[model samples]
Target: MFEQIIAGIEGRIGGPARKVVVDRGVKPDNARHELGRHNPKVVIPLGREGIEMVAAGNPDVPVIAGAILHPSPSTARFHTTVTLNTDPLLLFGRLKSVAPATKRIIVIHDPNKSEGVIRAANDAAGQLGLDLTVIKVRDRRSAAWMYEAVFSSIDGSKDVVWLPTDTTTVDDTVILPLILEQSWKRSFPVISSTPSHMERGVLLALYPDYSKIGNALGSIAIDAVGGGARNGAVFSRQVQAAVNERTARHLGLKLSDDLRRQFDAVFPALAPLSR
Candidate 1:
């Protein structure tokens, strides 16, 4: 999907001739060989670390946009939306600190393949002394109905919407608009695993640094292609928490001074600029 988008943009710019090379996963040594086979002038790998590795090998090869896979290890590994058990616990802790009075937290679990996320959310809620309302969406493929049910369940109730790291929910067509609508109607805030959600309009995001992942990958790619000569290199990973100030303001939520300072990016509300 990203490759297609980049290709379209390149078509307009009359950029270098391009062809895509995809892999099942980002294993540093394996990716280097794959790119070597293609031997394209430029290789743009999705995920921060992948991009960095590629850049490390072929420093001269131009790398454009980078994809952020997982925001953090606790939340979920990037690309795969399945959340680890530790993710929900971290999320619950964050919620407890922010809205200690919160009693019922609504979680939408994908019925098809997210039993783990559901169980983890419930467990996290228990740890935080909160009641968990687990709503399982029967049709995991259709995000519209899943979101509709989530909003319907929380209507006229006091609850925070917890978004699990499920790929079925993260595609551009589904979760993004649902989040925007819920925020507009009820001032409800969303706690999510991906920082991209924060940029899109979610109230807060507690996840890893996606850009860092891309940068890491880029460096590795350069080295594998014999580019990073000056510096000794190794695989790198970094994690951090982030939030969107604009989304918080839109929902009339105030972020703690300490949190605001710690986040990687803070987007303001999009009301004035939308027009």
Candidate 2:
């Protein structure tokens, strides 16, 4: 991913002045060498640890980061970041394309850890004329308990549950099976974060295609700051929606040829959906 991003960045600014570095997080000697070795135009750290190590080692360098899922609270001023997390706007657009009548989106989260994401989802839902239903699991409980509370209100015809990136409240092995089981019975769809979710019976899974993310990050950096970039998280618009044909089939959805075209990738091309 980083390599693709570097290739993209270099495309804009013609030079042999970039590298797709393997991040050595917080290793003092290596960090020093890597951070100090380059007085190049921009330093783009691929992940969170790389971003951190770069900031710690040399705050003066302009750093553009990629593949970090969540933006840090105290991000440095000279560092600009692009994340692998799907943008809410893009998610809404794709959801609209593939399943237009999805009237409600249910989100389960540990509210304390996910206020921002929940708020963004709510905004996205409102804009698309959908209700954003939130199920706050203040504490972790059994998967069955969580499912019962969540499924009690799901309207099979109009409701869809959105699985956020939060793992504390809903781990895949525990919560996904229960959610898929309930949704299967009701015949509603579920949207989630990773592409794997599509194979696991989730109707739609939205994620970043790393190469695409790299392209966007480089483009944003180029447009925003040519030679000198500053800190602030850039919302990456590069997103991929994976569809589960089996789940769609069960719901009686003939995902349109046009709608199918919206997906950047689909999972289980030939494998059966998990129970």
Best-matching candidate per TM-score: 2
What lDDT does the true structure give each of the candidates?
0.55, 0.70
- Provide TM-scores for the models: 0.54, 0.84
lDDT of 2 by residue, 1-275 (tens): 66666666666556544554555546666676766776655566777677777667664646677777677753545457776767776777677776788888877787666666777777778888888877777665743476687788768778888877777666777667777777888788888877777767888877776666766666656655565545477556777678887778788878777777767775543333344
lDDT of 1 by residue, 170-257 (tens): 5556556656666567667677776666666676666644444444444444454464433222112334555667766665567788
RMSD of each: 10.4, 3.1
Which residue pairs show backbone clashes in model 2?
77-231
